[model samples]
Target chain A: MSVLVVLEQRGGKWNRTSFEALAAGQKIGQALATPVTAAVLGSNIDSLATEAAAFDIQKVFAIDDAALEQYTPDGYAAALEQLIQASTPKVVVFPHTYQVRDYAPKLATRFRKSLVSDVVDLKTVSGGLSYVRQLFQGKLNADIPAEGDLQFVSIQAGAFRAAEPASATNPIEQFRVKLDPSAIRSKPEAPYREAQRSVDLGAAPVIVSVGRGIKEKENLPVVEALANALGAELAASRPICDNGWLPMERQVGSSGQTVSPKVYFAVGISGAIQHLVGMKGSKTVVAINKDENAPIFETADYGIVGDLFEVVPALVEEIQKTKA
Target chain B: MKIIVSVKQVPARDSSLRVDAQGKWLEEADLTYEMNEPDAYALEEALQLKEKLGGEVVVLCAGPQRAAQTIREALAKGADRAIHIEWEERAAPDALTTAQLLANAVKPESPDFILTGLQSDDLGYGQTGVVLAELLGFAHATIVMEVEPQGDAVRVKRELEDGWFQHVSLPLPVVLTIQSGIKKLRYATLMGIKKAKTKEVKTIPASQLGIDLNSGLVMERIYLPTRSKKTQIFSGEPKQAAHQLVEKLKFEARVI
Candidate 1:
């Protein structure tokens, strides 16, 4: 039995998480004692195929087709279905990306299987494989065992470190898929940014992010004052931006910007996995919330269980004094 | 512009969850429930589309009797009617099984559009809509932010990662999983709530759907996530805690 890792690329550039999926695939391959084969699909992906071949894998399949030049669930799923049928790999892995989410389920369903998505960890128990994923917004963890022979799994971003390329050069094979134009139902236009991102939160040294715990739009300045005192950019969770209190660009989470500031101050945020995945890379995390059980503290280096209204103002005052 | 919006009832966002004795699902005795957040947005989008294009909006939900409350909320907000597929099992089905059940109920309607939440709050399979589309031979899109009905098709804006957006046009009879917070939700008026009680709610047992219930994925166990980091908690008065935090940021973190 062999493992196939499907890598995602847009405009010839790989999604960084592709390597993470590769890393997870490598580990899984080792556990199962199977060879790992990587696949990249696009019109002209020879370079991508060669790049993937540099990794310590058995071989790379460059599934090239003109229909795949643009991503539609139909084209990608149909092509991958053909590849899977021909290769007959025991396992299929993806990076749990937006594009993968769009098509992987349908592809798995074609094989009479379900995709175990956003898997963060896996282990072999009694010679059977089991995958671990977050549930209830990361409050709980569930262990799901593989049921069928051909298991479909999508690795969560950051769950596994990206695999580095080795000196070994594997074989690159070109697999052409025959896709009919009429079968591609959805017509995809060019992807575009919504607006000129006014705030470059990624470059910010420090960010004071607010969440549902902040109460109301009127209460925003309580945290804004803290951001001002610390000379940090003001950011918020999805709900705050959804309420129009903050612009969509200022939102930081899975749907918004992913930031890795020098310091991240999470004020009244409960640290749902959605928000946690975005900011977990921050060098230093400080959480201030009334609920001591808030999941944000799990990722935080330092935490204070106090009302933000009381703690934030005092902290702002203390910071101003310290800076003075 | 006939539209079918699939929704699920989940524990209220603020309800603290507790694992049941079986360690397979949440304890349901004391939990309050509401319409799943993203599904609520899908219902809202369906209602808006019906209002503009003038067609029926049908609510399709699969859950226990408690799910009727959420169905009524959708009818109160503006769905023309609802189809309730009663699933009585305490253990939720996998995404494929759930989609098969939904597809069985949805096949008779032949709706121009089928909208579902991007993912459920509980299982979070995030694939029922796509799987349903595959089952019913309909085109599908996920993380849809906007939908506009064109002549015989629809134009939709889908959210990509990192603030990017892609516009796609799909022919009618498509399934679209809506993103959360795409549009503001509408509350039920007192009159609408009263009217909702009189509206038609067709109930069908999940077992009668004639679909296989066997799931491809099984949950072995469920438990609270173990804390990976030992967070340093500062316990004291708010002012003193703030002072301590400031000092730590300067000396320990060195960010400010």
Candidate 2:
């Protein structure tokens, strides 16, 4: 039996999360005693498949098709369904990217299987494999067991680190699938970024991020003052940017920019999984939230369980004094 | 055009969630429930589209008897009618199973458009709409930020990762999972609430769908997230804690 890891590619560029999925599949495949094969689907995915073959995969399938040049739920689902039916793999692993989110469920349903999606981690249990997924935002995690013979899994981004293959000499195989034009329903225009220039949070040395605890738009200036005192760039969680309190570029999370500043000051942020994953790599994490049990404290190197309104002003004064 | 919007009742985002006695699910007794955040956006999109394009907005939800409250809320918010798929199964149903139940309920309606939230705030599988589309043989898109109808086809702006967006065109009978924060959510007026009482709610039993309830992933157990870093809490007055934080940031962490 073999496991299939679907490699994501767009415009001849490989999505980095594809490597993360391959890394995860290799680990789980080893436990289940199954070989892992990486499959790349697109018109010109030869280079993408070749790059994937450098991983620890047993084989790479270059599933080239004109219909796959642009992703449509109908097209990708129909194509992958045929591939799965032909080569019955025990499990199929994918990176939980937006592209997969578009078509993965349709693919899973075609095979009459469950799509255990946005899984954070997986482990081999007594008799079967169990995937871990967060519930109630990030407060709880559930270990889900696979039930059917053929299982589909979508691993969340950054859940697993990408590791190199044992050697860079894996074999690559080319496969073609016939797709019906009539079956492909959605016509896509060229994808474009709305913002002409996005602020690169990754290059920032220090970032002061705010979360839901900031309460109102007026309170943002309190954290803004703290950010100014520390001489750090201002950032925020999804809610702040969503509320138009901050520019979209200033948001740090799975949907926002991933930042690894030398110092990350999280004000009133409860550290939801999405927000945490974006800033978890910060060298020094200092959290200021009123709730003692907020998840942000769990990840913070230094945490103050008090009202940010009071703490932020004091912290700002102290920082200015030290600078003086 | 007839549009169907799938809405779900979930624990309010700010609710203090606690694990159940079985350690398998959340205890709903003390938790407050409301329309899922993203699904509310989806309902708003459907209502706006109906108002502009002249169609009936039908809200569909699958839950226990308590879900009727959610359906009624959707009706008050401008849905013309509703279809409630009462799920009596005790086992936690997976995304595919839930989609099947919805597909069975939706097939008879043969609506030209379908909309659902990007995901529920609770389970957050984010796959129900796509799965439902597949089961019903409808073209689908996800993370939809904008929906514009163009004659026989519809154009949608879909949100991608890293602030990128893609515009796509799908023919009639399309499904879209709406992303949150797309537009301002509207409140149900007093008149709308009264009108909702007169709207039709077609209730169907989950057992009547002839679909296997236990056919997918099963939750083995659930527990609180394990903390990787042992956080040292700074107590006392706010000023003292702030002073201590600055000292630690400078002397211990050395980031400043």
Candidate 3:
């Protein structure tokens, strides 16, 4: 048995989700006694070939084509379907990303199989394999098996650990698949980055955020001072973002960016599941809310139940003193 | 233009959940079922689109008889009519199967566009929209926040990571998965609620809709989630404990 992870890249850059998929695949592959290999489809993916070796992957299959320059569901799905057929993998892993959402099921459908998607946990069941998927807006979880020998699965963002680059002398293979022009039904245009967001939070490691507790936009300076001291980016909750206290990009919620920062300090922000779904996987969660009963406290490793107006300044002073 | 919005009924978010003795899904006896939150957004988006673009909006639901309440709610909010594709509780097929069924059931109508929630509150598979697009061979996009009819093509804003957004234009006859909270959901008007009872609600079986569970995907089992919890305490004075807790948050939980 072998497992294949479809590593997704955009604009010639590997997405963080691909890393999450590799991490999930490594564990599942070990449990199933199958080696984990990654299949990447893009134009000149060889440029990013070194990036693939960081994961504890057994092998790397990189397919190159001009039609794959941009992300089109048909082009990528066709490429993956052909790649999977050659590998005959028992399980397919993907990040529950927008790209996967577009085509994973179609690829599964072509093989007469179905997908068990957005999984939060992967376990070795008594029979074969089972995965835990969250339901009811990140509340209940249910275990489901692939009904057959082959299964397709997508993991929730940040569900798996992207441990420090796994040290392995994993070999890379150039997988050249014959591409049928007809299979590529859609031609992708050049990827255009939306001009709205000034700061792309996808890559930020440290985020200092204030939420409803800050009261107004003027109070943002208090949190900004802390973020500046820590050399971290400043973000906010939905209410603050909605009220234009910060740019929409700084908002961490269902409607905003789904981030997994190394350190996320949420000040005066109530932890709604919608917000939690985006950043709960942060490496460190620290919350400061005036209301001790705030939901954010449940998820915070360190909870500060106090007024952000006073606590933030003190925290900023402490951090600045440390820096000095 | 005629558009179809696919809806699913799900337990209310935050509703306490439990598994029955059969190791199957819990009964919603004490719980209340509502039109899945994300789906309500889809219905709202479709209704708004129809209002502006001059078209008919049809709400499609696939579930038990009780799910008709959800459809009635949709109808009362101005869905021209409703389609009830009935199935047993256990018969709630996987995303691929449901997408196939939805494609076949709606193919006869040949709606110009189809919209559905990014994912359901119950299963949260988030696949049916994309699968249906593939099954019907329609150009598709998922997690759409903004949609504007641009001549024959539709311009859409796709929600992505870290406040990132993508603007893509797809030609008509497409499928889109609507994101929640993109637009305000509409409530049924008193007049519309009274008129919904008179609207046509067609009932069809999963089988009659050319959706055979035999050829479709099957499930092996469904069980409860496994959970294990542990607690750790820092022994010291209040101030020291607070410092230790912050340190743990940074080093251990990595959630600071």
Candidate number achieving the greatest lDDT relative to the actual structure: 1
Judged by DockQ relative to the true structure, which candidate is superior, 1 or 3? 1
DockQ of each: 0.79, 0.76, 0.32
Pairs that clash in candidate 2: none
Q: Backbone clashes in each candidate structure, one number apiece?
A: 0, 0, 9
lDDT of each: 0.91, 0.87, 0.76
**For model 2 chain A, the run of ten residues with the poorest summed lDDT:** A162-171
Stretches off by above 4 angstroms in model 2 are B89-91
Error of 1 at B69 (Å): 0.5
Estimate, for each residue in A1-324, the C-alpha lDDT of model 3 and write its tens digit: 688988888887777767888888888888788888888888888857667866677788888887777777777778888788788898999987767877888788777677877787776777466777765545456677555678788887757876356766567777776666665544444444456777767689899877777887787788888798778988888767655667777878756777788888888876655688778768767787765545566676666766667666766655554446
User: What is the clash tally of candidate 3?
Assistant: 9
- Please tell me which predicted candidate would have the highest TM-score against the true structure: 1
Tell how far residue B229 is off in model 2, in angstroms: 3.0
Ranking by lDDT: 1, 2, 3
How would you encode candidate 1's per-residue C-alpha lDDT over A1-324 as one tens digit per residue?
A: 788999999989999999999999998898889999999999888888999999999999999999999999999999999999999898899999999999999999998788999898987889987889887777778899866779999999878989999977899989988899899999999999886898999999999999998899999999999999978999999989988989999999888999999999999998877788789889999999887777899899999999999999999889889988
Alpha carbon lDDT at A304, candidate 3: 70
Q: Please identify model 1 stretches exceeding 4 Å from their true place.
A: B212-214
- Candidate 2 TM-score over all chains jointly: 0.96
Which residue pairs collide in model 3, if any?
A257-B163, A264-B256, A283-B254, A283-B255, A284-B254, A284-B255, A284-B256, A285-B255, A285-B256
Q: What digit string (tens of lDDT, one per residue) describes model 2 on residues A132-189?
A: 9877676678998765689899988778997565658688877778899887888999
Docking tier of model 2: it is medium
